[model samples]
Target chain A: MWLIKHIPPMAKALICFTFVLVITSVLIWLLNPVIIPVLVSLALYVCLLPLHDWLTNLGWRRDMSAMAILFLMMFVVLVPGSLILAEFNEQAMLWQSKASIAGQSLNELLGLLSEKLAQWQFHIEVDQLKANILAGLVKDNGSFLSSISSLVMSISSSLLLVPFITFFLLRDFESLRNKSLNSLPNKYFELGWLMYFKVAKQTQGYVRAVLIQQSILAVVAASGFWLAGFDSPVILGLIAGVLGLIPYVGPALGLLPPFYLVLANPEVGFDAMYTAVLVIGVAYLVDNLLVIPLVVARFANLHPLVALLSIIVFGNFFGILGMIAAIPLLAISNIVFYQLLLSFSPKKFTTNVASFH
Target chain B: MAGSPFWQNLFRPDHKQKKHVRDLWLATPIFSGVSANQCQQLVNDMAIRRYENTEAVFKLGDVGIGTGLIISGSVRICMGEKVLAQLEEGDFFGEVALVIEAPRTATAIAAGDTQIVFFLRPQLESLLSRSPRQGAKIMQNLAKVMANRLGSTNTLLEQSHVAD
Candidate 1:
């Protein structure tokens, strides 16, 4: 105990840092099944903190306020969400019925493309090419269908878990925070609280800003798609909104789905494809020009390279969700790292003057 | 604490404990003028920590966060080998840190098993934003405490000068 107390504060800090990191890693591993839902709940809690605070200030009990806010969240999110899902389901069934004709048209289109390329001295076998493409798509489709069942299961579980986690978090998070912080040695107690508050404040701001910006972008993109007469406009807009959160490549990735749909359906004109391109371009323009400036003011301070690396790394590990979460997570990590590093410096104090000022 | 019904207790396990602490805080210098409801709002996020005998609550040169009220036992404020003040229950120290991010000027060590309730800056800021009236009363009381301490120190310096 004496030796521990005598250790340099920085050394103690480093030990504590490593201890927290290890505990977090182990907890993440242990809670893997419910991790996504927990994260979603936490993000929702952050977004709704102001509302909850307002309710509590109105003399509402914490439990009752949390319950009311949870219901509000469910109504706001689920109503629109269910409508979009229903529209998407109808569109998906229609597309499924048209798959045979679409496949025939796609083959014909590819054959014509091969001939055009051959005219430019880029000779290729259309039959072999079609076979390979069909094989790859079939493989992907099989895997996609297999994954859907698991996705459904995960969603079902999250439906039950998100509200439960969010409710408890809203009601008792402060008490939980205080209890955990009390375990810190008195020396680091202040540091812990400072770090916790700094991290929480920054994270809450960034998450709320991002959610707001994305929702607006989704609306803009969906509106543009509807104006351009695209199928599954809501779904496409949602994807574009999510993808737009990524830095450089998001807009291009957002273009792929509508373009692919255009190619699969021969009856859809090239004019619709052109309109899709123009609409996406304008949608992203609004996002960069209006939404970001108005909602977020400044983007995360990460270098383009860092943002790209995070997107690639997270995308590789966790796929689309990881890609979507990467920048925010990186931004948060930046804030945490900055705060922790700043804490290590000795606090500055002014000297006492002889005369009262 | 155990007398509450199961649901209420489940939702707020520390309800009784918090009420007891709030009553104690009402007597502290910083909360002297604050009403019960105001005190409850102000102390909503205060944490009670227990320290064993002879343990250092904080040391000189450490960054101070906010004030701590001695809920039980006693704490001795010291600078090096000097015995500055012996504070018992209901006394509070480190109030200056609530207004400024400064290193502690002295160390405080527990005389025995001591329980202290901390009102940190974040909670104070939160209170200020949520209910300015309560926040202003506490801040006013804090200023008075600091002023009283400064007046005493000035008097002591003048007495020493005369003796010299």
Candidate 2:
């Protein structure tokens, strides 16, 4: 351990980074089941930082301000969340009925395609194909329901834990950070603060951008769905908004629900599907052209390949929550790595260039 | 900065010592006229570190982000081989860094095992946003300290010129 002191500054940074990464990974692995709640609390902590600062500026003590913010958040979320859940429940029941008819129609369409293929000497077996498809669907549905139930259980547990964690984080995060930095050797202490502030600022901005991006996508998509005359515009909009957080494939996935609903009324199905597609297409175009460029691009300028790879890897390990968090987490990591790398550059040791002094 | 558990427990700063350190901060020109309660609040945001004897607190040309107040023992401020000043208990160095993150003009090393409290630029910025009145008072005091130092330096220059 004393040998660490003799290493070059760049090496020290690398060692520190590796140690931190390993510790974090191990902690996350150990806390795998509760990771979601912890992550949610952290996200809430970051998102509410500005409001926390504003309240403290108004002469409120940190604990009181944090408490008030938590209360405000609960009120803001619960009221709308309950309303949305009710609407979603009603729409979901309707969708379930429509889905059965849609499934039958899709099977018939597939059968027709198989018949046409048989005429071309493809030797298609429509009956066998249909049976296999039904079996697979049943199996998938069974797994999906189990997964959903487990997800609900975790979320219910998290609902109790998130506030308690966020409260402590809100009140004591700075001191906690300082205490952690206190363990650093004297030589790296200032550098530690520099990195801490830089990372915190970047992460905060990225989280804020994500919140705004998600809201815009949800509002725009829901409005579009409503315009398309869908019975469950809000639910569809919510799904689309969340899915749209994913990069390239998300917008396509967002199309599935409306298409399913359209299938129930086969005569006018194509017309409604076309309208829905156009509406969503315009929304996606606006997001890519306007919102993403202005809000998210400034912080999360990750390569498409990197984003996709990260999403797949994280999804495999952590499921849907991981997929949603992949981009932001990746961006934060990139910022930390970049800052650590910057510490190695000789240019940084130069005299301050600020005109203020 | 980790000490053996035995040594850590042995040298652990007590409430009395901490209060004494706060009192020392209150006496400093940069914190002059600040209320003790306000000083306590500001001090809560600062950091303290212990340096071994002959250890460099910071080296020349190192980026300085904050001022350091010696809480115990002594510090030797030097440039190259020349001794610039020997700062004792309650003395502060690198105060300019609190205003701007300039390179430290001189290196500071501990004369003995020394404990120093740091009031960094980031904390100052946080204070400014969170409690502007307290922040402004400290900044005002900091300006006055700089002005007095500049006046003394100017007088010293004038005296040398007249002697020549």
Residues B50-164 of candidate 1: C-alpha lDDT, one tens digit per residue: 6677878887766677888887899998876887889998888888878776677887999987878898988887778677887888889888888888888899889989999
| lDDT (tens digit, per residue) of candidate 2 on B79-108 | 669887899999998888888756677779
Local error of candidate 2 at residue A45 (angstroms): 2.1
Q: Can you tell me which runs of candidate 1 are displaced by over 4 Å?
A: A1-15, A89-157, A185-187, A290-300, A335-357, B1-20, B41-44, B79-85, B99-105, B140-164
Residue-by-residue lDDT tens digits, candidate 1, A1-357? 999757665675576567767887799899888887888889888887888888888899999999998787678766665566566556555654555665576678778889899899998877777666544332245332222223334544576577778888999988898867766665567777877776676667777877787788889888998877787788778768767776556777777657656756767864577888888898888777754454333446667677789889987787666776777767656655554544554543334522111
lDDT against the true structure, per candidate, is 0.72, 0.74
I-RMSD for candidate 2: 5.4
Whole-model lDDT, candidate 2? 0.74
Best candidate, TM-score-wise? 2
